[model samples]
Target: MSIIRSERRNRYTTISNTVFTNNQLSFQAMGMLSYILSKPDNWSVSPAQLITVTKNTAKKTARDGVYAILKELKDTGFVGIEKLSTGDTNYIVYDTPIAKKPNPYNTDMGDPNTAKPDPYKPDPSEPTLIKTDIKQELKSNNKDLLSSKHDDTNPSDKNSDSAKQVIQHLNAVTGSKFQCCKSNINHINGRLNDGYTVEDLCLVITQKQIEWGSDGKMAQYIRPSTLFKASKFSGYLQAAKITKLNPDNRPVTLADFDDLTWGKDLGL
Candidate 1:
């Protein structure tokens, strides 16, 4: 499905909020997403938007200060970032480096296929580089099959089943018409413009419970009615954005987040 652009841009605010809490990001990260969501969508918004927004709410210069926040937000799974080719000369070549994922159990760094370690190895030293690489490889393999029996870190595929579940949950939760400071309820239709079912929406709430936070604070950011002033419901994760769909062939012209709310004393 194609992205529900322009007309359906506000519901993402609530989606990002729930995503932030369930994923364990700092309030600063959450605040940044809240700000990005408030801006207008035009292909993409740059770091300049982040810098301006952060500096405004927080008294510090956001120029140098935006990256760490961006990284944290990225790490916490609050935002989906894509490296689009900007025609500007300075930026034309900037997206060259793709973040490499760890390779298979094979630990040969020189080989094109082996998994590189997390945080790529810098220009290596002259001494024993090959030996060190082998040792690290052996250790990594053994740690999984033999050495450490207790593996708490999830070894799940990031974009796999559970991840899809997480996405569905997000899509379901944000599939509501944000009660913005206007009387037009057209955006709050009973059927989700983004195509979320009631069951799918509840699963997100369940998933949120599975993921805990360090702060232990209850989530207040997703209350759409409570936050009807700044932005209304934006569309959910448009599958075109996440799925590998051919842009020219996608079905939905726009997947909307408006009209996703479950009202009080309604819908048992």
Candidate 2:
């Protein structure tokens, strides 16, 4: 069976298929998560509000059902509850289940105003780098790449040095002339700011060249725009890492085979 999708240009939520395939979550929980994600980052709803919207708010059975779904969401790591001193509760919803301890203070979950100070931001207080989870890392990278805000650290002279090095490596492996222009720097800096080491970037370029270098059509994608894209970089890195682990997967060139003295051992 195939699923048809509408072309959503604006106000659409991007969710991973992992949520749907998650056997641990019920259909009701999935629906609730979709509804929560569809709203603005600052949008919040209370348990009482949900119960009140139910068929019979005055009945205990209806309230219990609401509470059960909420509990399931919480236990499954889709939501974290924070009770404020002012007696208002905030729900911290995540696109993916929490892998680490849920920091209630974390404001990256759909909030425009991030309460937690992110070092990856363009104008970080210090010239230091702080590694973050993949979700926050991707968000920071996208913001740095898209926004017009340029600082000394993120999209500045200091940042271009590393991006140049990455571009140089790409050129070295792919034999292509790619300069550290705005577009190239933006994509390279995005990955750099995401805590990917220089070695990681080099490995990705080297591996992609080996995989795509032979085919003329595929070789065109060896450019910075394709290699360092946000959606494709991590996956390429993972694949490159696997190739590094298994050296046997490397291409067997003409050097790998030796000319044999045929029938030398045969008593002809």
Candidate 3:
């Protein structure tokens, strides 16, 4: 029986076309939101807990500041909160696609009886190497069954061409001009974090696709959601901007990004 592990987090929804989500939040707001969302699943935290403990735990920001931070996250739709009858509010955490899996639960070397036919029998002259022994140690016995699923029986199929086009596009935005080849698709996939969509990557080069390479035009492969993520990584805010100002409702700017210690670490 196959056993899927219990998930630590769950993504209720994903944001696509986040181009509209720019500069909507301040850095402090972003950090607070990240903290809230990153908590382990099943561990629902209350606002009082946050107001008292979390507020001054890592960053001696403030008790009231947590409220403001949560408010900011809610505005962006990154996280939501609920008010309990106990008057203790709780943060609503969403799952991201980038969750990790535990190590292989089991493994099998191989079954010799299932070796190739006499004409193409396993090479009795040599031993198998450790690295190439099993693609997935856990499911080694079903190797052939697994490979048959993705078998490219026809290289000239229309579907095949479309798939190749997508790969080329992925290569470009990944800073891979001509690197990740068809055989390395899994490797590339492994590196992509959840929450990233092909459209997201395309946005990173959408302008470039329009612009000329030495050739003339480059294609875009990133999805809208992924692009928004990149926008965030690039210091671009989602439509959820929080100027990071105080309750005074003052305006915050890029200049004050690192100036204030609102969310500075208190060394635990």
Candidate 4:
């Protein structure tokens, strides 16, 4: 069956809290649920289709990995799988409730068995309306104000928060006395906005600290100003990954560090 697009404009899916709380579920399983929920309700999908979609979105692309995630999602009651009458075809179906268009005239009045009220009948108990337009305008303005206050964070604030987190992680890992400064914050925020996650930054820092913590020449360069500079931050990320894969191996020469601009070349 074809998927239906309703009135929702954001184009997002809902993931319930239980999915996170379930110890049996992994991150891959949660991602699969999100993909399923994004489709229209009652839509049928096969195990092969799920595996393909999961492979595209997640890092764990093994067939057994996909099967394990699907099994977990199924066992948790997040999705249902059924075998058709043909007995050869199996379809996985999302079990969540779907949204239906609201009707103004057909009010259920909280009881499904209740009879519909006459539209022609005027109720005298209804409250009298006065200055409704002005009241509605005021309410709308208040709502807009509240939305502005709560919905979005200032870009500067986001940058500062991300920078602070990076700095905190660095201090914890390197045993350094580095404080947040305008220059380092801008550099850290720039890398973060370039699509590197906070965890990625921390991993880079942790790997570098382990590599350079003892060397007097390199230890001095572990400060925020030297490591987090925009021109060299990407190189440090690559270097960290290299170090993680080969902890004991070191670059052959100092020139090797100069050629470590892989992150810069990728525009990371």
Identify the leading candidate in terms of TM-score.
Answer: 2
Winner by TM-score between candidate 3 and candidate 1: 1
Say what the RMSD of model 4 is: 24.3
Compared with the true structure, the alpha-carbon lDDT of candidate 1 equals 0.32
The sequence of per-residue lDDT tens digits that candidate 4 reaches over residues 148-263 is 22223345566666566667556534545466666666667777888887656665665565556545478677767777677887898887667656734322111111121222
Worst 10 residues of 3 by lDDT: 251-260
How big is the positional error of residue 94 in model 4, measured in Å on the Cα after superposition? 66
Error of 2 at 202 (Å): 1.0
Best candidate (score: lDDT):
2
Worst 10 residues of 2 by lDDT: 259-268
**Tens-digit lDDT track for model 3 on 1-268?**
8988666487442333331245866777655555555555665544423433332245555334654565555555555554445322345654322222332642544565544332212256753222211112213222212222444435544333323333444332232333223443332332244343333322333232222221212223233233333335344222112321233322211112112232211100
Model 4 lDDT, residue 150, Cα = 28
Candidate 4: misplaced stretches above 4 Å? 1-156, 246-268
**Could you give the candidate ranking by TM-score, starting with the highest?**
2, 4, 1, 3
Which candidate would rank higher by lDDT, 1 or 3? 3
Each candidate: RMSD: 22.2, 25.7, 24.2, 24.3
Residues 1-268, model 2: lDDT tens digits = 9999989898688887767875878987787678667768876554433433333223322333454566667777777776555223456888787754655755556745466443223344464322212233333233223222332334446667667666655653443556556777888878988999766776787677667764548868888889889999999999987886684454211111111121111100
Identify the runs in model 2 with alpha carbons over 4 angstroms from their true place: 1-155, 250-268
